[model samples]
Target: MAEEEKRASPEPPLPSPPESSSQPEHPPPETSTPPATFDPSRMIGIIKRKALIKDLAAAYHVECLALCRELLELQKRKDEPFLDTKATEDLRKETLRSSSKRAKKKR
Candidate 1:
């Protein structure tokens, strides 16, 4: 325990700067770069556009699921509906393949 404590202890502090050194008495004051002009209308437009895109994407997914559900319902009613099981399996495989690639690495 004593050996571990010694090992964990920090090193000595560094020496302070000397006062004898004759540095500049008064260096010129630093000038700040001006801030960019604000546009309230433009900012509002950008926010609205982003929200619209999000809503559109959500609506698209909902529509796709609704369509798929309708097709399933139709198939259930008909004995021999024209639904391609192979295409469904292929889509599943493709989705899994892409997901596996993403899973191997952290974003």
Candidate 2:
């Protein structure tokens, strides 16, 4: 009966896989060259294109600032009265002088 019970039991499960290490097994050498597919001229062209875009953006910013200043000045002028106090004073003096001259002529 013991021999028959042993034969009927299933085999034990396989052992669990080995625990993985946090670090890589082998690191690449530091002195390795870039891949042959990489082209230096292509990188240079990309850098020049970026510089051109930056320069154009800066020029656009300057032009926008200048236009904003011009618009602000125009708005300020529009807010001002048609005739300033100084000009009104001069006009009043001219009118008084003309009226005095007319009175003198009538007398």
Best by TM-score: 2
**Can you write out model 2's per-residue Cα lDDT over 22-41, one digit (the tens) per residue?**
76789767777766797899
Where is model 1 more than 4 Å wrong at Cα?
1-40, 79-107
How many clashing residue pairs appear in each of the predictions shown? 0, 0
RMSD of each: 25.6, 15.2
Q: How many backbone clashes does candidate 1 have?
A: 0
- Find the candidate with the highest lDDT and give its number: 2
lDDT of 1: 0.85
Candidate 2: stretches off by over 4 Å = 1-36, 82-107
